[model samples]
Target: MLTSTFGAPLAQKSARAKEITKCIAVFMAKDMRPFSVVENEGFRLLINTLEPKYHIPSRQYFSQTEIPALYKQTKEKVIQTLRQANSIAITTDGWTSRATESFITITAHVITDEWEMLSFVLQTRPLYEAHTGVHIAEILRSAVAEWELERAACGIGVVTDNARNMDVAVREAGLAPHVKCFAHTLNLASQAGLSVPRVHRLLGRVRRVVAFFHRSTTAAAVLTSNQKAMELPQHKLIFDVVTRWNSSLDMLERYLKHQSAVAATLLSPYVRRNAREIDTLDHADINDAEDIVKLLKPMKMATTVLSDEKTPTVSLIVPLKHMIESSMAPNEEDSATVSAMKRAILDNLSNRYTDVYDWLLECTALDPRFRTLPHLEEDLRQDVFRRLREKAVQLSNKTNVTMEEADEGDGGEGTSGPTPAAEQPVNLTGTAEEAEVEQPPPNKKTALEDLLGGTFTEPAVAESQVYCIESEMAKYKNGKPISLKSCPLEWWKENAKIMYPLLSPLAKAYLSIPATSVPSERVFSTAGDIVNVQRSQLLADNVDMLIFLKKNM
Candidate 1:
């Protein structure tokens, strides 16, 4: 056997070698590096220098053994954590990589018993089948079973984009309480507005101007010089993508920011002779851009808020929708193009989101920050609270059933048949002495009082469960809303046990839902890095393990 100068065999499984191999695997997964990185001369030298006795494994060793083992171990830990979750909400989306291979990514969001929000990337499996609704539905069902989420004690909802196929797939999978991505809906509406001929033409001219600067090095240099001369922030122009509406807004904002520099650069004597293709925006166009920005600024803010993964955002959808609708309302001072654009957006959004509105409204009402629902009218507000109270009663009943089942599981309560109730006051509001108020004789009742069931002090019946629910609702209603900076989970953690036990669980169910498919979308963003040119031929199974470990570990 070959031996090093120190006389130990080079490839023996020492502790240091095992630890270094584990570190190398983690580096590949977490940093999105190709397995072959270990084989690179520079990387090999660095490892050897760090630990002369340690042997660097081949790429085959890491890819075949180390990565798979890491993924399996990390997956077990994630599954354990997920099993502890009472309610889970999922976000899933499909992506096509640079290799032209299709894949689906699923991410799970849960609110722990302690009211802390956690998210985990479940998988990113390559799709060999057609991207049909039935196929997608099957994939989703398999994913739920694989993750052990099908047996969730409470609800399992899914958030997805507004793709018709996704809607069909989620419905087919029977993941009730499906919510369309609010950001996607906003983008659809914005795209519709941008399709108006006048807006399209204006944007075409802006796109051309931005393209000119991007393509012409001389023109870009001139613009930078002009920016410095004008004492402006040296910001580069943003190019918009056709698929993303926010990117258009970003481009327009950057264009407007560097308007002075751009105008000077385009009008420079040398540029007039050299690059005559650049278009100049007139004053009216500038005003139109400003109006469009003003109209879309609220939506941009709403999108940012709903795309939040760290905080609860499903509750923000309805409130943010109301705000955007108000902003889109026609103003007398609006330009024709702006007015047309607003109408187009409103028309597109008019009949949308009807399917998920009820539950999202419930989420809004349950969220303490927006419980009052100032955006809604008085009657609508009442309706929301009514539905909330009804649900609370249902939840209470379900909890009772669950507790009973558990008791039965514990050996039939040792043949007690059923436990006896404590002889406490029906309202549970008075002391023991106060609850034992002296009752008058039956004959002391007046005729009217006897007909009406009883007098106020001596009620005829016990307090109904409905009344108890109403009291809890009232107490929750009277609470002052927490600040916008406070996390709803943190607030619930503080109060769920003692203050509003019944509603707090319901709050977790509603608030755990994500408002967008951005979690899965983010996974694709990382996937792009993993499946780049260097690793394009990576196998689908390896890709799955790598992505899972990358996100989870």
Candidate 2:
């Protein structure tokens, strides 16, 4: 093949396309005032060699025209992707920016025919009305309609924080089955655990100590030097954010890790001048900090496991809830404040999540890995199993025996291919010409089921009911729970269709429920970066466009 030149002649782009391109580039760069940047002598000089003939658009063009056009295009694509889903779950949360503007993020979760998981950030619209249950529900309904999911065959559910307003909103929107974010619940428990007065005082002192080191380069330098001399790792001091639940754990862990270095640094003349008596960590302070960190590690893991979107988290909800609650009882070796914290956590989990276990039991009961119905209270166990079987049969919507299709000219089974012997044939096929134009045979069950095994040759009701009974009965076999590391979705995707056909739909439905609304909360973290001091003047509409493109594109 002949070699082509490094660059080739190209047609000039339309002003609108060029404008959209520049605004997206600038928006993604987290920059404000595109015109100023484009007009800069250095910026112009750098881009000159790459595109000598092109000119950058004015800020007015980007703000007024390009952002709106780009948003419209991206939104259409998001809707198209959403329209293909058999079911949809949503995760939403609200945030306030440094600009003091309130915004809500909504993301849709869907599972494809091949058992692949996908998500789309549907909207990051500003919240103009009061952020109440009714208002949030209204916005959610609009988002649902925009994606045409209001009339969607498979239903929609929302995962959100356990905040009262959010709890009220999903119910008001008629999207409830009590699917609060497990990760957020864990955080709240952690929060309550730390609320004991002494522990609270300890955390306050820790933050102050960290704050002193955080803003002081001299203090950090002295600490690092001491760490080097002591042959310890020179880790940075961790600071806590008010909104981040685990920040205190992180601060304490880091402080304890460099405990000796910090002690040495505080004695240095520069630190002595700045640090107060309260900033110093005594032996008791160190012990309390260690206890807090030890208690929080498992919770952090629980948060991480639930917040994950790549794997199934819904199945882990009940099991992890049990794990978290069992860990809440304090050992006798624990200090008085630490004991109080554990009891508080225990109380919080019991009160806040009394109904959650029942909701999650339905999910766990359907999972093949953790078929531990015994995990549920004895009174509720059988009911959960009954609900599982009922749910599967209902969702399958395959209650009646299927009418057999005519195979031969006499509507006969004489030309038997693979039809099961149990269901005798009944001719449903019409005239040859009409049959030719018909949609694919309704003999096939589910798309996922077909992937595991072919169309059902047996009568539908007998087969579905058998699978339903088998699924409920499977729970009593060997009461051990699966490893936390196991992926229940993969187990079902690989085997459930063949083993428990009726329960497959239930498996897919509950497995697809999102464990956390962190996807929406994560959008706000990105929003914080996008709307910083440098780009403080970014308009609300354009900010929405930039965020949409950043995520969707």
Candidate 3:
């Protein structure tokens, strides 16, 4: 009877009731999980479920502005936590996007004396138009001050790559002595030292040949079938020069074992094309191939040498020097070949090994102040020479031993002597007048000398003055524990105010704590991680929030 009178209204009411039931069920499901554990997941799910209600008629429920307000509230809390840290270090680095807009990210972290890393803040901003040192410094200072750490003594270090602008900015900001990233330096040195251009070009040719064979399905199948005919199976292979060199050497040695199959494979139509290209290669290419083969031949010997568990008794330099001496020795027959090999080795060393030796010498000659504290200067020097001698020995051992053994053994057990100390030879041509340099006066006290003071004062000159003060102070031994009540506080304070006017700036400088660049470096690394390509769309406010959250959490 009720439905007959108000059936349309009842249907509308029933639909609304179902909607309410669904909302209640979703809310209850979300509430059952720990709030912190499921906040993000639950929020996303709720947003998806409420899609229709957002535009539904006769409903004015949730506000869109509330979500943003909640985010703001959380961000503020994060900022407060960062501000509470005692000290923070910062890092900053510049990044560019595909669109070519440059951005700078600054990161802050709190450090403890025990070297605990606590992430503090990370912020990204559009690199300012000027991008000058001053401008960069201002940006960094603003970011640090934002966290209320502008005056905090907790900023112990800054770390950065060797960029002049970034380094200058760090110094201008009064964050001195920044540590250049050691790992980056090592990588750069290794890349420069080990990347042989000739080797690279040879490897490139190998890659091209491999690509030609592998690109076509027919060529790959032919190569595979041929490999199988030779009692070998084709496998996925890379055109690594080192790997290929070893493989080629092994195959060449076993040529008699598989000569028929090898001949067939090489004469194949696909192989013919590769061989034709190889045959037409220039003399330089042939030399490169020979050189590569020769260089790699020593690898087997090198591996054998490395496998020996015992450290070689002889130093590296001695063996290498001995090898050079032996190779250069006069021979009745094969003299030309010996001479050519010796010259090639010498030329290679002069070009490649000179810099390494120079660097070692420079490192060894560094001031005693820079030497490792526990090791004495003599010990440090010995250690360096020992390493060099060992490497030399290994190189010398690589040469043919039988022919040169008699010649080398002539010098007896001590055949190869220690490398002579590298000296700065004086120019004998210079006049005596030119050699005589001016010297400072002996009485002129250096900063350190002044700080140390005289060994003993002349007693006659200042004795009376010291005795008068001591004698007067000795009378002040009242039974009441030297109470100030027995004497005027002003008189006592005035008498104690003796000034040391002779103190030097160096002495004053020593009183301050040693500053390091580690803090700046860490900040730069953190900044790089946060403002990377994947997160480029982050807005300024969100970036700030993320930085604050990272620093605190």
lDDT of 3 by residue, 428-505 (tens): 112223322232223455676576545444344245433443343232221123321332222223333342111111
Give the winner by lDDT: 2 or 3.
2
Could you give the candidate ranking by TM-score, starting with the highest? 1, 2, 3
Residue-level lDDT tens digits of model 2 in 304-357: 777788776776777887887788776878788778988988887777656556
Best by TM-score: 1
Task: Name the better of 1 and 3 by TM-score.
Answer: 1
Candidate 2: residue 472 Cα off by (Å): 8.7
Candidate 1: 10-residue stretch with minimal lDDT: 421-430
TM-score of 2: 0.79
Residues forming the 10-long window of minimal summed lDDT in candidate 2:
422-431
lDDT of 3 at 389: 32
lDDT of 3: 0.39
Model 1 gets an lDDT of 0.80
lDDT of residue 122 for candidate 2: 81
